[model samples]
Target: MAIPRVKHFEITLTDEGVAIIAFNRPAHRNALNGEVYKEWDRSLMWAAQSPEVKVTILTGKGKLYMGGHQLASTADIDESKSRKAVKESIVCVQSLLNTLINFPKLLIAAVNGPAIGIGMTTLALCDVVYAVPDAIFLTPFMQFGFCAEGCSSYTFPSRIIPPDNFISDVVAIATKTTNFPPIAIFQTKNLVRARERETLMAVNRNECEVLLER
Candidate 1:
């Protein structure tokens, strides 16, 4: 069946134990806005309480995973609106990440394409991550005059990447550089697998099989 827009989430069963939560927004590259956040929060809560869902695979509909908060949503915000939007945004992201972090079930991120800003940090909380080799990443908050949120401060450094991957340099840049890509700044074995974008569905299916086997 075709999935609808309106910030709705698509949950499909891949196996007995694996569920996929696809962020079904293509027009804006699945960017998270307030409405999307509300829907995502509701969807995650629903999944968390469902007995049939043993794992959740986070992904996007179109080529891009997510480009972070919708730039359009940021438009016309007064100081109060900005604060409220930012605060609510943080809460929405934190709520989803916390659910994944503490959920007994596994959380896997299928990075079909670029995942910018909170999109990148959210993956850090997942149990496993799979990325397309060509995926671009960005954390543009500092460059946009904001501080880090979504618990990335603790999660980022705690994970380790390959020595040859320049983990230290990446971390240093994220810490010092304005609006840097955290994915490039650190490496991690947490990424259990990686693949080309063309094979994303196959890789997702394979990951689901692995999760079911566990």
Candidate 2:
């Protein structure tokens, strides 16, 4: 399939069904804006509907994986939110995160370099996270005087990193997993994350509430 182009990222689908979504705004350190969020939501929806995509690999361009949110995009969101607005925002992001967490196809995050903000937290949602030797992971929530988003508060302390190595450890497991029947894979994935959906949504609401109060 032809790759889709946007202001913030690139999505490439391979014949082998490995869809790679690379953040392309290296000039801004891959900082996410409203457009990126829109593209992300749409891309995930496309992937969910397309049988051609069996797995997705998310990464970034240039030296840094991602930096933080774009100021303009979040400024209005922070300034004018009512209770209903806050709830809506929370529900929207939580829905997307849940879709990613419970994605039908496999999800992999290749942290090419420093990953901060959502970049750091999103690693926890991916089925596999591969970081280069120099890759640095940081939440920067405390540094920014914010709490958490992307469910890192729950995932980070839990040592969400699976296995010791991505290739030998995770790939081997994924190979075995995919070798199984597709229905079996879906069931196993669903069972593994059965309660996590509710937990993550609750966490997202809580975090948003705290942010609103602060």
Candidate 3:
């Protein structure tokens, strides 16, 4: 299956059935913006429906994995349009979180470098995470006076593997996973995630509501 074309993400499906979604905004440190969010939603949904793709791996294009939300986008909002801009931003974020919470495929994250803010919090949504030795994971919500988003409040305790082979190691694991029966893999993931889906959705709603209030 052909991967969908996206401006902010580079999507590729390997022969081994691993779909790699790279955050391609290197100049912006791979920050998430409205366009990126939309692309991600489309890409993941496409991958979930692609029989050729049995696993999905998310990583960054450059040194930094992801810098989180594009604060500059918010900074650029005109004072006169502040309310509308904030509300749109809240909707965009909540929509992305909803997609992640309901994603049915095996999702993996390869932290190439620093993962800040939403980048750090979203790792909880991945089934597996691999990071380089110097990769920094930080959620500075308190500094920004914002509560946790991305269901991190309920799923914060994540396991991380240090760089032995980085992307290659992650790909190896994904390839192995793909070798299993696809239905079994999908069902197992759904069973494991079923218990927390509701909680994650609730957290996402509450977080977005608070952000909107602020």
List TM-scores for all candidates, in order. 0.64, 0.77, 0.92
Q: Provide the lDDT at 183 for model 3.
A: 83
lDDT of 3 by residue, 1-214 (tens): 5789899998888898999999999888898877788888888889878888889999998788999887755557787576776678778888888888888888999998999998989888888788887899899888877777877777762346666667887888889998788889779989998998888899999888888888
Q: Please give the distance, in angstroms, between residue 123's alpha carbon in candidate 2 and its true position after superposition.
A: 1.0
Candidate maximizing TM-score: 3
Worst 10 residues of 2 by lDDT: 157-166
Clashing pairs in 2: none
Which lDDT value does model 1 have at 192? 37
Q: Which prediction has more favorable TM-score, 2 or 3?
A: 3
Residue pairs with clashing backbones, model 3:
none
List model 1 lDDT by residue over 1-214, tens digit each: 2222334567665334455678878877788877787777666666566755555567776678788877643457687666666556555655555554544445566777788977887777665666666677788877875555444554442233333433223323223322333243222312432332224333333433332332
Best candidate, lDDT: 3
Error of 3 at 159 (Å): 6.5
Give candidate 2's TM-score. Answer: 0.77
Clashing pairs in 1: 161-187, 170-185
